[model samples]
Structures are given as structure tokens and as C-alpha cells.
Target: MSIISLRSILDANKLSGNNFNDWYQNLRSVLMHEKLIDVIDKPANVAPQKGESNASALDAYAKYFEQSTTTKCIILASMSPELHRQNESMTPAHIIAHVKKMYESESRTSIHRISKSSFKIRI
Candidate 1:
């Protein structure tokens, strides 16, 4: 019901600028989509109850993260890069590769895999 910037959300959580914003933005999109689903499911109803509890947009976001083990892990992984380093020889390429693997392995396929030529970190 409210439009909050990704920055505000991250700031509230005491999270610095990182991939969390991107992830949260995508998650917000997902939350908006579920809101659309709620409107479709209940035409006259504003607040829909999920069984015994009234489900809000935040609840949906929380439920999604709670029930989905892979998504939870992915979120944590994005926040903590140190978890990916198993060996001292790990290069940026290796880190990116591991992230790619995790993204591919997840149930969600939203992460884009761009060709090297298409992506340049520094312009």
C-alpha cells in the first residue's frame, strides 16, 4: 500500500549499499505482484486473511523468505560474500562463478547471466 525506496528499506535494516538493494527491489516487485493476486482473489475485500492470520504485504514478503530455504540462503549469500570464499586462491571470477552457481541452483530464475562483452564494471 506504501511505496518505499530501496534505500530506505536497506537503511532501516542497517544494511549498507550492496546487492541487498537490488534483491529488495526485486522482492518488492514480487510483493506488489502478490498484492495484485490478492485483489484478483478478493474483489471486494481489502485485507485478506490467510487462514487464522490477516496477511499483509509485509507478511507475504516474510512468508516468502521464511518458507523458501533457497531464497533465504540466496539473500544471506548476497549480503555476506565471505561465505563464498573456501580457498585463499579465490579470484573475483571464482566468486562470481560461485554466485552464478547459487543463482542457477535456486528455484527462482530472475538473476541475469550476461555475456562478458555485454557487461563492463567500469565505463
Candidate 2:
């Protein structure tokens, strides 16, 4: 286990739409620690088909399924109720993409505006 408590490591702060950058970084840290970041990035293929006989294939799909489910729970628990409701049906990967689309560009534009304004501040 990490020296840091899981609570601290996971940054219990929920994503309320105003803290996307911080929330994103925190999530990345947690996923990386769990070694499940790929579940949200690559999104492995669907579960093995019924009647599948290959033991390795079954094990691979099982691993992906377990990891994906854990990632989804983490993402959901870190979201505000409204955000969770909107994304609860989505897979972990889809939820991340949706959040990025909603906030990543917005944050960049906001930062640009802030920088421009700060450069002109009298104090």
C-alpha cells in the first residue's frame, strides 16, 4: 500500500465543473496507481463471447472487466450528483471523454482570459 492514505491519494474532491484540471490530475494519479489507467484510455475490447474456450482470452477479458468496473466506480464517486446522473450510464472511457470535451477547452480559454486580464491589472 502507498504511504499516503487512499483518501488523500484519491483527492476526495468531487468534480463540480469548476475544478476540472485539478480533478483530472487527481484521477490520473489514482488510475495510474491502480495500474488501471488503460481501462479509461485504451478501453479494451468487449468481454469474451459466450462459449469462448481460450483460457487466456477469458482471463484477459475478465481482467479488463474488473478493472473497467473499478474505474467506473471511482469516476462516479468523484462526480457531483448532477454530473454523475448525466454520466452514470457511460463507460469509464466515455465519461472521461465527455468531461474533457465539456471542460478542457473551456478551462484553456478561461486561463487565456485570466492571463490577459492579469497582465493589465494596475496592482
Candidate 3:
């Protein structure tokens, strides 16, 4: 995607801490579109060790690093500043897992709103 389009996508779904479900779904869509979502499932040690010169291993590391960095940037850019600060040091996979663990449950206010709306029926 063009930079403009990517910026647009991130802006639309920018995570505000409580909107985890919507933000994560949008992130997945963007990553899938860029074919980078699989990076989140790979171990962070996919990086090659120094002087470990197997051609295939090096190639794998190169691809892994590219996908990891790109996906990481996308994930970070879509986050709130607070979340970005908290997760800045983690790998893409770890960041996703951390945030998912932290925010997967809808906030009480959100759940209450949904419940309230769902029951607002009139005869």
C-alpha cells in the first residue's frame, strides 16, 4: 500500500486503550494485506547469530527482520502514545501478545453500553 493509504488506515483505527477489539481487527487486516501478519507468530530469535553464515539461515533472518520491523512499526503507529511507550522495547509478536492479554476484555463501560443498547426495545 502507498504510504498515504497506510497512514489513513492507522489513523482510522488508532488504539485508544479501550478499543482493543476494533483496533486489533484493523491491525490484522492491514498486516494481512501486507502479508506481514505471520511475523507475529514467529519467534523473535529468528535473527541470525553473528558469523553464522548458512545461506538459507541468513536469507530467513533477512526476511524475518524485514517483516518484523514493518509489522512492528505498523502496530506501534496504530497505538496510543501510552501504549507505544509501554511496548516500545518488545518484539512485534510480544507486543501483540502483551496488548492482547492486557486489553482483550472489553471495559465495563463498553460492555454496559452494549448491554444497554441491546435491551432498549419499545413496544
Candidate 4:
């Protein structure tokens, strides 16, 4: 797919800290639809050890790494400036994990509060 197309989509759905789940879902859906999920889902396979013929694996790794980094950059471009600053040095996987941690904690805390309120009402 063209970079222009991807950029346009990201521009329209740009993320700015809040609404992370929605932003992530839309971004992921677009990426998957473009058949570029492997770039984010799979890391480059390890190189072969000494004395082993690793030509094919090396080639695959190189291609995967290139695409992965490109995809990571694209995804980063859609994030908020603060999020980008915090995660600029991170790999795509690490960035994703960080975002999930931030948002999922909010969800968990909400659930806990709701449960506590229910218990209080019963008691």
C-alpha cells in the first residue's frame, strides 16, 4: 500500500493520549487490512549460528526487520507528542505494551471501584 494512503488514514484517526482503545483498534484494523500485520506481530527471526547456512533466514530477517521498523514508525506518527516522546526509543512491541498498560490499568481500576461499590451496597 502507498504511504500516502496510510498517512491519510492515520491523520484522520490520530491518537492524542485519550481514547487509546478506539485508536488502537482502528489503527490495527487498517494495518491488518493492508496485510501488514506481520510487521507488527512478528519480530525478525534470529540469525543462524556459526557454520550454519543462514542465507534464507538472513534474507527473511532483513526483510522483516525493514518492514517492521517502517510499520513501527508509521504507527508512532499517529500517536500524541507526549506518548511519542516517552516511547521514541522503544520498539513497536514495547510501545504497544506501554500503551496497553496505561489504558488497561484504567479499566482495571474502574472494575475494582464498581465491585467495591456493589459490595458496599450489599453490606
Residue pairs with colliding backbones in model 1 are none
Q: How badly does each model clash, as a count of residue pairs?
A: 0, 0, 0, 0
Off by over 4 Å in 4: 1-6, 48-53, 107-123
Superior candidate under TM-score, 2 versus 3: 2
Q: Write the per-residue lDDT of candidate 1 for residues 27-116, one digit (tens) a residue.
A: 445434434323212222223445546446657656543434332333344444454344224432343345446544442432333333
Ranking by TM-score: 2, 3, 4, 1
Q: List the candidates' TM-scores in order.
A: 0.23, 0.88, 0.80, 0.72
Q: Write the per-residue lDDT of candidate 4 for residues 32-59, one digit (tens) a residue.
A: 8767776667764565677777789777
Model 4 alpha-carbon miss at residue 16, Å: 1.7
Please give, for residues 6-123, the per-residue lDDT of candidate 3 as tens digits. Answer: 4467787789878888788788888887788788865664567888889999887888888888888989989989999999999898998899888776555688887888888531
Evaluate all candidate structures by whole-model CA lDDT and list the values in order: 0.40, 0.85, 0.81, 0.75
What value does the lDDT take at residue 80 in candidate 4? 79
The candidate, 2 or 4, that scores higher on lDDT is 2
**TM-score for candidate 2, residues paired by index:** 0.88
Reference-based lDDT, residue 110, model 1: 29
Q: Which stretches of candidate 1 lie over 4 Å from their true place?
A: 1-84, 107-123
RMSD of each: 16.9, 2.1, 2.9, 4.6
The residue-by-residue lDDT of candidate 2 on 1-123, one tens digit each, is 646535354447889887889899899888887788898778466767788899999888888888888999999888889999999999999999999999998888888999999989956
Q: Name the lDDT of candidate 2.
A: 0.85
